[model samples]
Target: MSFYDVLARGDDALDESPRRSRTWNFFSHITCNTVVGLSKIVLNTLYNVEVKGLENLDQAMVAARKENRGILTLMNHMSTCDDPFIWACLPWRYFKDLDDIRWGMAASNVCFTSKVTSRFFSMGKILSCERFGRGPFQPALDACVRILSPDNTLDSEHIFHGLGPSTDLAASMAKNLKEERNPLSPEYKPPVLRKKTSLLHVFPEGFVCQLRPPFNNSMRFFRWGTARMILEPTVAPTIVPIFSDGFEKIKPEKVEESAFDFFTFYNRGGKVTVNIGKPLDSAIIDGFRDEWRKLCLKYTSLQDSNRMSDELKFGEEAKRLRSKVSGYLREQVSKLRLQNGFDKEDSRFSDVNWWVKYTDTKGKSDPSVKFVGLNWACRDYQSNVKIYDEKGNLLQERKDALCGPKAPRKSH
Candidate 1:
C-alpha cells in the first residue's frame, strides 16, 4: 500500500497477526532483545544511569497481574529515544515476557512515512497516531483503550469502517454493520473473549519539549487523549507515573541538525536518571470514573432517538472532564519530578488554555511548526507567544515574538 493509504487508515492498515504468530514471535524475540540489549549497553556503558523507585514498578506490576488489571505508564517526552532506551532500565523478566512489554504511540507523519518504517515501528508495537489532523480524538487512542480493557475486542473492520479509500456502497455497508453492533442498542451483543491485560506507556505531553536550562525538563500540559484510556476502560488500569532526565542530552534537539542524528548517540559520560513513581490511588481514579459514567448517562439521555456516538454526544462536559483528568495525571508526574530533585513547574503548565493558545498559532506565526504541530525549530524561553481570541483580538503578548526569524536569541 502507498504511504498515503496507510496514513489514511491509521493503525488499521497494519497487519497485527504477527503479534500472535509463533514464527513472528521468534523474530520479535531476537529483534526486541537485540535492540534492548544495545540500548542497555548505550545507556550504561556510554553513560551513567541511575534508577529509583523501581520497587514501585515491581509492586504495581505484581498488583496489576494479581488483580487482572491493565497497566498504563505515563512519562515525560524528552527525546525520541525515550521509549526503548528508557525501557533498558526495566528488568530482563519484562523482556522475557513479551506480553508485559509496552505498546507505544508514534506520530504517523514521522514513523509511518514509508512501508519499511511503518512495518519497523509496528513490529516494535508502536501504533501510528495522527498527531495533527485528528488531534486527541483519533482511532489510535480508541485502540489504546481497547488494549487496556480486558475482554474488549476491536476488529480491523470496526476500526477502518468507512475510513480510507472505499466505494460508496462499501462505506454504507460498513456503517450499517457498525450500527447493528452498537453497544447502546438493546439487540446488540458483544463477542465472548479471553481476558487479557495489556500494558501501554504514553508520553501525555504528546510531543518533545526539551526546554532551555532552568526549565530543560519542564513538561507541556498533558493532552486529553491519555484520559480516554483512564476513564473508558472496563477495569481501571494500574497508572504509574515516571520521570526521567538526561535522554535529551543523549538526543538533544539541535536547531540546525536533525533530531535523530546518529552521531549524537556516540556521546559518553552523561548522567541519566529514571524515577518510577507509585501507582496512582485507585480510590481517586474511581471517583473520577464514577463522575465520567454519570456524565455519559446524562448526555446519552439528552440525545435524540438516533443517538450519536459517545465521541460526538459527550461534547463540552466530557471535554472538561478529560482536561481535569489529564491535568491531575500531569500533576502526579510533576510530583514525581519534584521527588527526583527537579524544581516544581509553574502552575500555568497545568492550564489547558495556555497550551491551546500556543497550539492555535501553530503554523500561522511559525512555518516551522509543520503538519505534526510544534517541533524544536523555535524555542522561545524568554517570552510568551502572542495569544489571540477567536475574534482576532489580542489576548496576550510579550516583548519578544514566539517564533520566526524575528524571535529573540537565547541568553546564556
Candidate 2:
C-alpha cells in the first residue's frame, strides 16, 4: 500500500469508541508478546540499547506490587523507537512475570489510523487519544486511570474484544483468526493484582521533539494534559522520569512512511541510552504546585490581558502548570544525561531560536534538508525520489518526497 492510500482512508480507520471482548483479550496476550519478542532482537541489534537507573523502575514496580498502586512513567519523546527500546533494555531477566502490566497513551491518528493497527496496539496495551480534537486527551487518560485503579477487575464487559460487529466487517475476521490459530488457548484474563498494579507511560510533550543533538534544548515544555493526568485526585501513580538518548540516528536518508523504515532504522546499529530518574510522588508534586501556579499565572496573564471565563481560566492555569512540570522533568533528564557523559554544557543548543543561534562549527547547520514539520533545515537542493508500492512495484517519482513531517516511528 502507498502512504497516500492510508491517508486517504482516515474516516474508515479512525475509531475513538470503546470496544471489548473476552476471546480477543486472550489472543492479545499471545500476539502482543510475540511481536514484542521479535522486536527485541531487532532493536537490541540496531540500537545497542543500554539501560541505567534500573533500580528506579525496580523500586517503582515493587511499590506497585505491594500497594496495588500504579506507576506513571514520564519520558521525552524523541523517536517512535523509545518504547520498544525501553522494553529491549529493561532488566527483564530479574522480572520474568512483569510483562503485561505496561500500558501507553498513543496518538489516536498515527497509531490507530487503521483497524489493523488499532487492534495491534490495543492488544499491546496502547490506549489511543486525539491530539487536537475536543476532549482529545480524556479517553486515553481515563483508560490509564481506570486500569491503574486498585479495584480494577478483568470483568468480561471490561475486556476489549475487537471492533463491534456492526462497525467494521473485518473486525470479526480478525477475532476468528485469533481463535482459529489457538483453539486450545486458555481463557484470557488480564492478570489481577491485589492492588491491580500497572505502569502508565506517557510523553508529556504530546508530540515528538525535534531530532536535535543530544543535551540540546530541543525538548519542548510539557503540555498541561500530562500534568492533569498526574495530579488526578482519584489515583496518583508515582511519577517516574525516563530519558532516552539516540534514536535520531535511525532516521533514513529519505524518511519514508513505511514500516520497513522502522525495521531498517533499528537494524542499522547505533547506541541508545535509557536512564530512569527518581519518582516524584504526591508530596513532591505538591511541593512544586504553589510555585507552579505562580509561574503559570504570571505567564498566562502576560500572554492574554483580557479576563478569561472560568473554564478558560482553569485551562490557562492548567497549561502553565503543565509547563512547570515539564520543565522540572526536563532538568531531571538533563542531569541524568550529563552524569552519563552523553551531554556537555557547551554542546547544548538554546530552545529559543535554535536555527539562528546554534550553527555548526563553521557557523552553518547540516546541509541536508530535514524532513518537514518544524525542523532546522540547511540550504540544499534535491530531486527524483523513488516511491514503491506494497508489492515492490515502482509506483512514482517525485522531488522532495521526503521533505515532510518527520514524525517519530509509531510506538507500535
Candidate 3:
C-alpha cells in the first residue's frame, strides 16, 4: 500500500475511535478544530483578502498532471498559519485541481512525539532531523528524496513547511562576515540544497518577523543550498520569490514602546496580509549563489533597518498595514472554515487539561517558563527536549513510543 494509505489509516484511527468520548482527540476534532474553524469564519466576515501574485506559484503538480512539468515554489517563512491561509485564498480548484498536491514541511521530531500533533498535523512520514545536524542526516535526506520523487504515493498529503528557527540567521551572517567576510542573519540555516525535478517551497527568511520598514534586515539569508539544490544538471525548476505583509500585526513588539511604535499593533483580530512576490529571475539565480545571496540579503536588509525605530518615528505605517491585513487574513480563514464545512466553536480544550504539559530547565515547571536569555521561549533549547535518563541523558527523541495503555480514562 502507498504511504498515503497508511496516513489514511492514522486519520481513520481517530475517526474510527468510538465516537462518544470526552478525550482530547475526541474533543480536538469535535471542539478545537471546530472553534478554530469558527474563529476563521468570524475573521473572514470582516474583509476580503487579495492574492496579487499567485500566478507566480508554479503549479508543479497541476502542470505535471496536465503537461507533466514539475515546479519549485519558493516562499518566505512567517507563521504556522501560512499554508491554510494559502489554501483558503487560492481557488478550491487549484488544490482540488491537482491529482497529487502535497506540502513539504520541516517539523521537529519532538512535536510529533505527541499523539495529537504526531497523528494529525504531521500525519505523513516525518523527516526526524536535529536543528543543526552537520553530519550525515539520512532520515531527513531520504524523506526529502521520497517527497520530491513523483513516484511517491498520493495517499498522504505531504507539505514541507519548515518552522525551523530563523535565529541562527544572525549567526549565519556573523559566520559569513567572520569567515567569508559578508553579513546576514537568522537563527537557523536551511537544509542543504539538492537538485530535483519536484515542487519545493523555499522560505528565504528562515522564520517570521514583520513590520519594520527595513523589516528585519536581520533576515537570515536563504541558504546557498537553495541555489546549489536547483542549479544541478537536473531539470531546472522555477524559483519564485514570495513576500508577506500581514504577519507584521503579530509582530513581537517592543518595536518601540513609544505610543507610535510597533507595540501599537497586536493580534486583536487585526488584519494579516501575504504577498507572493514574482518568480526570481532565473538568469540571475541559476548557478549564481553570490547573485542570489546578494539579492536575498539586500531584499531583507532593506526591510529591517527602519522596522523598529522607524515605526517609532512614523506614526501610522503599521496601523495602515494592520488594518488592511487583519481584515484580509480573517476573510481568507473564514472561507477555509466554510470549505471544511465547519462553522461552530469547541470550548473543551479551553479547560487547560489538554494544554501541553510544559517543564523548564532545572526540571522546574513554572519558573523556567519565563523566556530567559532571549525574548524567545526556552522550548527550542536542547534542555527543552527532556532527557529521559538522568545518567544517560537520552532525549525525548530516544524515549519509548508514547502509545501506552490508555491512561485511566478521565470520566467526564
Candidate 1: clashing pairs of residues: none
User: What are the runs in model 1 whose C-alpha is more than 4 Å off?
Assistant: 1-18, 152-196, 258-260, 301-314, 359-412
Q: Give candidate 2's TM-score.
A: 0.61
- Predict model 1's lDDT versus the native: 0.66
lDDT of 2 by residue, 282-339 (tens): 6767555444434433432322222222332245555555556656666666676566
Q: What TM-score do all the candidates reach, one by one?
A: 0.75, 0.61, 0.44
Best by TM-score: 1
**All candidates: CA RMSD (Å):** 9.9, 13.8, 19.0
**How many times do residue backbones clash in model 2?**
6
Report the C-alpha displacement of residue 82, candidate 2, in angstroms.
1.6
Give the alpha-carbon lDDT of every model: 0.66, 0.51, 0.34
Residue-wise lDDT of candidate 1 within 127-209, one digit each (tens)?
Answer: 87764324555657756766675543232232322233364433433355443434334553332112357789999988787
User: Could you tell me the C-alpha RMSD of candidate 3 in Å?
Assistant: 19.0
Task: Give the count of colliding residue pairs in each prediction.
Answer: 0, 6, 47
Query: Model 1 — TM-score against the truth?
Result: 0.75
- Which scores higher on TM-score, 1 or 2? 1
Cα distance off (Å), candidate 2, residue 133: 6.1
Stretch of 10 with least lDDT, candidate 2: 1-10
**How far off is model 2, as Cα RMSD?**
13.8
